[model samples]
Structures are given as C-alpha cells and as structure tokens.
Target: MKITILGTGGGARAHTAKLVELGHEVFVGTRDPEATLARTAPDIMGNAPYKEWLADRPAVTLMPFGAAAAAADELVINGIDGHNAVAALSAIGDSLAGKTLIDYAVPYIYQHESEHPWPTPWGVMPKLDPCDTDSLGERIQRALPGTRVVKSFVTQEQTTVVDPKAIGAGDHTMFVAGDHDDAKLQACELLRSYGWTDILDLGPLVCARGMEMYAHMHSAIGFGLNQGFGGHFGIKVVR
Candidate 1:
C-alpha cells in the first residue's frame, strides 16, 4: 500500500516508521523541506540517529505536504495534533478527495497549557467541542465532503499507540466509527498492522460521539487513579 502521513511530529513520525517497517511505500509531509533535511542530515550521516531510526525499517520518502497528499494510493492517515487537524485537512482537501482518510484525532490536550495528567481536574474534558456537536471526525468529514473518513486510534493515548503491549493489563475498547464499509475494513487492517487485535466498530461516523465520550471516561480514570501510570485501554470480547 502507498501510505502518506500528513504530519511531522513524533507521533506522525512513529506512524510513518511503523508503516515503513511493514514494507509499504511511505512518505512524510512536512512544512519545510530544508529544515527537515538539515535536522536529519547530521544523524543520518554520522549513522547515529536517523540511520538508527531507519536502520531495520523500510525507506521513508520525505516530500512537501502537497506532494505527499497527491501520491497517496490506498490510504492517507492524518496524524497532525488536535489544533492543527482542521487546518491541515483544509490545506490538502483537494488531494484528499475520493481517498480513504484514516483520521486519528482527539480533542485532547489544550493549547498553551502545560503537559499534565489525563482528564485534568481543571475541567478540560469535553469529548467534542461545543461547535463540533457531531465530533471532530464528523467535522473533518464535512470539511472534506467527498472523502471517505473513518475515525480510528482516537481512543488510545500516545503511549499505547507506539506500544500496544501496554494495553495487556486490562480489557478495554478502542472504538471505531465510520460511514464507509470498505474504509472501515481497510482501517481495521491498518490497526492490526500496528498490533491492535481488539477493535469495536460502533457503526457510522456519528458514533464517533460515543467513542469520544469513551475517551473522556478513560482519561478520567487515568487522571483520577494513577498519576504515575500512563493511560491505556484495550478490548476483550467473550462471544
């Protein structure tokens, strides 16, 4: 599969690396080409960081955000953080048309705030913003209009996303909701590629409201229970 991830943060980079590991042709979208090269050149040359980062992994091609969007074939996973998601999609909406977009977004972590525990006590937990009564996924779907949007991986924290093994301690659910059948199936396959076996598909994109609420509950538990322990959840079905 030809996958292009439209973000360059650590989580976005991690997704790119994992997909590359699966032998898929991968491309990373970034704002500045020169800066990305300059930052990675030292490590790639000294065979220290970038070399080690991609040592056993497949080759990841870096391109401008526009080109990456244009080159995507099977899927285009949006990995930008909360605040930037809408704008990022807007910037590349044309290329995203008719493509199956695997959206991984959450209303997590407020801007201009220090990193704190999950479900912070300062009244930060609103599953969907007031304007987005339908949820972020639905908003993006509306923004794209023609794109097939499936919301996945929003229920899990960054820690669990990079390491699914952390979900071993409990039986929790990673809720998925999308209107398209083929898109959901493809997303399920991608989730399994990341070692996530247990998935609960909650019908169409509107179910994303429930999924986001579930994230709120999970975050509350993490903040209220164990501050030292990171937030993690996985599903167990007995049927």
Candidate 2:
C-alpha cells in the first residue's frame, strides 16, 4: 500500500510513522520539500523541525504535494492544516483523482476577532469556517469531484487515532462519514489496521459538520482534564 500524507505537521508525521511501521510505503507531501528540509526552528506547535524529524525516519520519502499524491496507490491522507487544505489540495486535483482521500482536517481560522474569545494555553481557540451549513470534507469533495473524500479521525488526537489501544484497550469508537460507501469502507479498513475494534458510520458527508465542529469541545475536554493542548483521551459512542 503506497500512502501519501499531504502535510509535514505533527499529526501528519504520526500517520506517516505508523503507516511505515505497518509496512506501507509512505510519501509525505509538503509545499516545498527543500524549504521544509531547510527549517531550523520548530513549528508553531513546537514540534521539532521537519528536517530533524525526517532524519530519524529514513524510510519515509518527502516530495512536493502533487508528486506525492500521484505516487499513492489509492489512499491519501489530507493532513494539511485546515485553513490552507482546500487551496493546497485543489492545486493537485488531477493527481488525486480516483483515490480515496481520508480527510482529518478541521477548518479552523487561527486569527479572528471575537467579542467573547475562547482562550487556551496555545492562545485563543481558533474559529471554524463553513462550519454549520458546510464543512471542510464537503468542500474538498466539491473541489475534487474525482476524489473520494471521507471525513474521519478529526475527533481524536493523531497519536490516539493511529494507536487506539494506548487508551482503554481500544474500547473507544471511531467514526467515518462520506457519500461514497466504498471509500468509507476503505477508511474503516485502515482504522481496523490501526486496531480500532468499534467504528460507527455517521452517514453522509453533511455529517462532517458535527465532526469538524467538535473541535471546540475537544479542546475544552483537554483543558478540563488539565492535559493542555493535545489531550491524551478517547471517546466511545455507547449503544
């Protein structure tokens, strides 16, 4: 399975490392591979520079966004930051045609003026755009009509997403929603490969609104637990 993850951020790295461990060929997409490799300082999230991280993961190949997407066998994970994802992915639409894009991005606008701001340890909580009526998943699907977009993995941290058993022996439930049944099945197959025992199909892509909107609540939960930033936890949908 050749997989392309279109981002160099922390979350993308998590998926990249796990997929490589699962014996899948992983290609990471970045805006500029040379620029990414030239970074000396950590990212905004304080994660180590991309070059430093890549040095340790010799198996992972890094390439420009389009090239990486074209190299995937069928699956591509859109790990690009929510705000910039649509534009970035739209540029590589041709490369992604006929592929299953499991999008885990939340459309967050990091800089905004709010009368009542929701502040976290990492600064003011970002606001979601196209939140209620539309969603990033739908936007991506609209942008790339030839691509199969499935909204998932947005409800949990990437670490927990890739290795669910680390929390509660993987008792928690993962969710997937998309208009394409076969694409959702592909997502579920990957989730199972990651050891997810329970998965709930949340119906159509419109349901992505709820998933993306859950970002605020996810942050609140982390603050409530005193975990700060990325909380180490999981949620189970009890029947």
Candidate 3:
C-alpha cells in the first residue's frame, strides 16, 4: 500500500516509520521538502530535525503536500498540526478526492489567554477550537467533500497508536468514527495492521467531539501517573 502522511512532526514520524516497517510505501508530505530538509534544530516538541530522522529511514519519500497526497494508493493520514491542518489540506483537495482520509488531528489553539490556564510539563495546555460543537474531523470532512473522513488515533500518543502492544499487551481499546462506514472500516483495517485487537465504532462524525475533548483527560492521566508528556499508556473500554 502506498500511504501519504501529511506532516513532518514527531507523531507523523512515528506513523511513517511504522508504515515503512510494515512494508508499505510511505510518502511524507511537508510544506516544502527543501525547507524541511534544511532544518538544523529540533522541532518545538524537541524531536530531532526532519532531515536527521529521514536519513535513517531511506525507504520513506518526502514531497510537497500535494504531490505526496496524489501519490497515495487510496489512504492518506492527516498528521498535519491541528491548527494548520484545515488550510494545508484544503489546498490539496483535488489530490485527496475519493480517498479514505483517516484524520488524527486535534484542533489545538496553542497560544491563548485564559483566566484559568491548564499548565502542563510542556507549557500551558493548548485549548481546543471548534471543540464542543464541532471537531477537526468534521471540519476536514467539510473541507474535502470528495473525501471519506474518519476520526481516529487522536485519543492516544502517536507511538502508542502505532504500537498498541507497547502497553498492556494491546488489551486497550481503539475507536473510530465517521459518517462513511467504508472509510471507518479502512481506518479499522489500518488499526488492526497496527495490532489493535479491540476497536469500538463510536458512530457518526459528530462523535468526534468526545474523542477530541478527551485530550485533556489523556494528559491528566499521564500527569497523574507521573509520566508527563508522551506517556506510555492506553485506555480500555470494558463491556
């Protein structure tokens, strides 16, 4: 399978490496391939520069957003940062038409003034926009009407998302929600490929609100466990 992941951040790197390991042709989309390759310093999350990371993964191809999206066989994972994802992806709408877009972005507003701020190890916790009523998944679906959008992979760290067995022997649950049943199935197939044993279909794009809203709880759980950010954990749904 030829898969396109539209981001150069840490989370995107996790998916890229895992997909390549799974023997899938992976094309990573960035704003500018040259600029991304030119970075010398680590990203905001302190992950190594994109060039340094890609050097170790020779099988992964890096291209501008549109070209990468067009190269995908049918699946495209939107790993673009939540805030900039809609605009970035909207620019490449044509390339993504008729594809199953499994979006895992949470619409985070990184810089905001709050009377009661939620601070974390990484700084003030980012606030979610279009949060309570709408979600990033729905926004992406609206932006790309030709695409089948599925909301998933947002409730866990990207590392855990790609390697569920890293925690609890993959006993925890994964969730997928989308208006298009076929698209949700595509997402579940990828999740299974990632070794997810228990997947719950949350039903409809609107349900993305709850998934996105769970970001705070995810962080809280990490902090409660003394693991800070990028905590290795998973949430299980007990029947």
Candidate 4:
C-alpha cells in the first residue's frame, strides 16, 4: 500500500511512522519540504524537530503536497490543519480522483472564533466554522468530488492515534464516518492494523459534525486532568 500523508505536524509524524512500520510505501506532504526539514525548534506540543522524527524512519519520503498526492496508491491522509485542508487538496487537483482520502484535520486554533458563543466547561468556546452543520471532511469531499472521503482520527491526540496504550486508553471507540462503503471499510482495516479495538462507524460524512465538535469535550477533560497533551485521552463510548 502506497500512502501519502499531508502535514508536518504531530499527527502527520505519528501516522507516517505507523504506516511505515506496517510496510506501506509512505510519502509525507508539506508546504515546503526543505523548510520543514530545516526546522530545529520543538513543535506546539513540544515534540522534537520534524527532521528528527524522520531520523528513525528514513524510509518515509517527504515532498511537496502535489507530488505526494500524485504518488499515493491506496490512500491519502489529510493530517494538515482543517482550515487549510481545502486549499491543500485543491492544490492536489485530479491526483486524488478515485482515491480514499482519510481526513484527520480539525479546526486550527485561531480559526475557532466565530459569532457563535459556543460554550465549554473550561471557557467560552470559539465558534468553529463549518461545524454543527458541516465539517472539514465534508468540505474536502465536496471540493474533490472524485475522491472517497472518510473522516477519522480527528478526536485523538497524535500519540493516542498511533498508540492507544500511551495513555492507557483501552477498548475505546474510534469514531469514523463517511459515505463510501469500500473506503470506510479500508479505514476500519487501517484502524485495526494499528491496534484500535473498538471502532464506531457513524454513518455518512455529515456525521463528522459530532466528531469535530467533540474537540470541546476533549479539551474539557484534558484541562481537568491538568496533564496537557500527554494526559489527553479521547472519548470512550460505553454501550
């Protein structure tokens, strides 16, 4: 399986590494590959440099967005921020046709503000645009009509996404939703490959409304724990 993942952030690093371990041919997409590799500072989560993340996994290739998507065989993982998702996919154009695009992006921190006074326990939540009614995944699906869009991995931290055991998260439901049956099945298999035990299939792309909106609940719990990103474990659906 040839997989192209877009983003240089934590999620991208985690996804790329795990996919590589699964023996998938992996390519990482970034706005500027050279600049990304040249980065020396820690990321927002205080993770090591991007180039450092690659040192252990040299098999993973880094390239600009266009080429990475063009090279993808099985799926394209959107690990970039949701605010720029459409633009990034738009840049890829026809290369995404007939492909399963697994979207893991959420509203970027700054874009969380809107007229809505969406309240959370910690504070008054910023209005997340395209949420409640639509979602980042839906936007990508609409923009790239030829692609099979699956919304997934948006609620988990990068650490939790790859290693659920990192925070002792066990037998938890990882919610995934999309309109395409085959693509959704492929995503479920991908999750199982990475050791996800409980997967909640939430139906169509429109169901992404809940997935993306869960960020508030995630934040409240993380803050309550007072452990920051490492302490943040996502939703555990109990039946």
Q: What stretches of model 3 exceed 4 Å from their correct place?
A: none
CA error at residue 130 for candidate 2, angstroms: 1.4
Question: What would you estimate as the lDDT of candidate 2?
Answer: 0.95
Candidate 2 matches the true fold with a TM-score of 0.99
Clashing pairs in 2: none
Query: What TM-score would every model get versus the actual structure?
Result: 0.77, 0.99, 0.98, 0.89
Per-residue lDDT for 12 in model 3?
95
| Candidate scoring better on TM-score of 1 and 4 | 4
Pairs in clash, predicted candidate 4: none
Clash numbers, per candidate:
2, 0, 0, 0
lDDT of 1 by residue, 66-104 (tens): 789889996998877656677778788888888898777
Instruction: Give candidate 1 misplaced runs (Cα > 4 Å).
Output: 36-58, 108-132, 169-172, 225-230, 233-239
* Tens digits of per-residue lDDT for model 2, 35-82: 999999999989999999999999999999999999999999999999
Q: Which ten residues in a row have the lowest lDDT in candidate 4?
A: 118-127
Q: Cα lDDT of model 3 overall?
A: 0.94
For residues 62-172, could you state the per-residue lDDT of candidate 3 as single tens digits? 999999999999999999989999999999999999999999998999879999999888889999998898999999999999999999999999999999999999999
For candidate 1, the TM-score is 0.77
Candidate 2's error at 155, in angstroms? Answer: 0.2
The residue ranges of model 4 lying beyond 4 angstroms of the native Cα positions read: 109-127, 167-169
